[model samples]
Target: MEPNGMKCAWFQFLIGFEIMSLGAYFPMKVYVYTHDFEEGGKENPKKIHFARIPVIGECIVLSNNPNWYKVVLVLHTPYMAADADAEVWCVKITGSAARKAAGYSAS
Candidate 1:
C-alpha cells in the first residue's frame, strides 16, 4: 500500500535475500574413509564405507540459514589412526626415492 495504491517492489525484493554472520561457529558431520589409496580409482569397496569422523577443531558450521563459504576445505579423508598428517601437509611432502626415475619431475 502506497500513496498511489501500488506495492513497493524495491522493498519486497530487498526482504527476499538473507545475509550470513561472518564469524559464526556451527556443528557438522564429516565422512571418514579407509586408508586404501592402492589401485586409485572410483568404485572401490574400501571407499564405499562411511564411518564416524571426529572433529577435533571447529572448521565447520551448521546453520538453518544457508551460507556461502568462499574457501572450502575438501578432505580426501585419510584412514590414518588420527589426523596427525595435518602437520606434515603444511610442510613439503616427498614420494619414493625412484620418483624421478619413474618419470615425474617437480615443475
Candidate 2:
C-alpha cells in the first residue's frame, strides 16, 4: 500500500472507523467518500458498490501523538459529491484537547 493508504488504514484501526476512499493527492486537502459504513457501524458493501460521495479537508499534523489526528473537513451541500456549498467540520481524535468535540462520528 502507499504511505497515505497505510496511514489511512492505521487511522481506521486506531479509531475503529472506516477510512473512506479518497480522491487524488492534493496539497493540504484529502478527499473522502462518506457512506462506506452503515448506521450500525457495519461495512456497507452496497454503498461501496454504488456511487461515491466525496468530501475534502485538511488533516492537522499530530507530531505529539502518532496514533491520532485532527481533520477539518469541508463538506458539500446535500452531502453528496460536488454539491459546491461548503461547511467546515472540526474533528478531534485521541490527542486533541477538544476531544472529538463534534457530536457526530465519522459518517
Candidate 3:
C-alpha cells in the first residue's frame, strides 16, 4: 500500500535507517532583518525569531539597526523517526554580542 506518495515497504526501510542513524549533527546559523522602520531617526526594532517546522526549519532575522547581520541558529534532532508518521520540530537561537551588551545595559 502507498500513502502520501510513500510506499509502505519504503516507509519501513526508511524508518529503520532513521532509527539506526539517529544521531546529533552539526548545527547551522543564519541572520535576518526587516526593512520596516519605527518613528524618529532610529529604525524600528525587528522581531527576531526562529522555528523548526514539520519538515522544513526556518530562521527569521530582524533588527532595527541599519546594518543587518545574519544570526545563525544551530540545532540537532537525535533519533528522528522516519516512519513518515513521525512529527518533530526544533530550533536554536544565537544572539549577537551587541544585542547582549545592550540587553545588559537595559537590565
Candidate 4:
C-alpha cells in the first residue's frame, strides 16, 4: 500500500477507537436542540430560542453534578479526520466561579 493509504487506514482505526472509548466511559442520554432566529423588521423584532429534541444515535454524557456533560454535536468533518474527529464541543451550564466557590462540588 502507498504511504498515504496506510496513513489513512491508521487514522480511521484511531478515530473508531476513540469514539468507542468515549461511548464506554461517558454513556448517558443525549438531547438534540436547535435555535430559530427571525430577521428583525420595523414591524416585528427578531426572537430566538433553543429547543431540545430527540435525535437518534446521538451520544449524550450526563454529569452527576448537573454542571458538566458531554454532548456529541456532530461527526468530525474530513478535514479533522486526523484528530479522530474526537473533538467534542463542551458546554457548562454552571459557571466556573460557582463551581470554584463550591469547592467543585455538585451540591
lDDT tens digits by residue: candidate 4, 1-107? 57998999999999999886775565432222322123221222112122232233333333344443223243332363342322333333335544564578645
- Point out the higher-scoring one by lDDT: 1 or 4: 4
* Separate clash counts for every candidate: 0, 0, 9, 0
Which lDDT values do the candidates have, in the order given? 0.28, 0.37, 0.36, 0.39
lDDT of 3 at 73: 31
Q: Across residues 26-90, which tens digit of lDDT does each residue of candidate 1 receive?
A: 22234322221233522211121212323332122123433211112235434557332221111
**Against the hidden reference, what TM-scores do the models get?**
0.17, 0.17, 0.20, 0.25
Q: Which digits, one per residue and each the tens of the lDDT, describe model 2 over residues 1-107?
A: 47898998888786654233232221222232223122443321111211233333333432354433343455545544642334333343443443445544443
Tell me the lDDT of candidate 4.
0.39
TM-score of 3: 0.20
Error of 3 at 11 (Å): 6.8
- The digit string of per-residue lDDT tens for model 3 on 1-107 reads 45765677788899988765543232122222222233233323322223322223333333453443322333233444422222222222334534564465422
User: Of 2 and 3, which scores higher on TM-score?
Assistant: 3
Worst 10 contiguous positions by lDDT, candidate 3: 26-35
Best by TM-score: 4
Q: For all the candidates, what are their Cα RMSDs to the real structure?
A: 15.4, 17.3, 14.4, 14.4
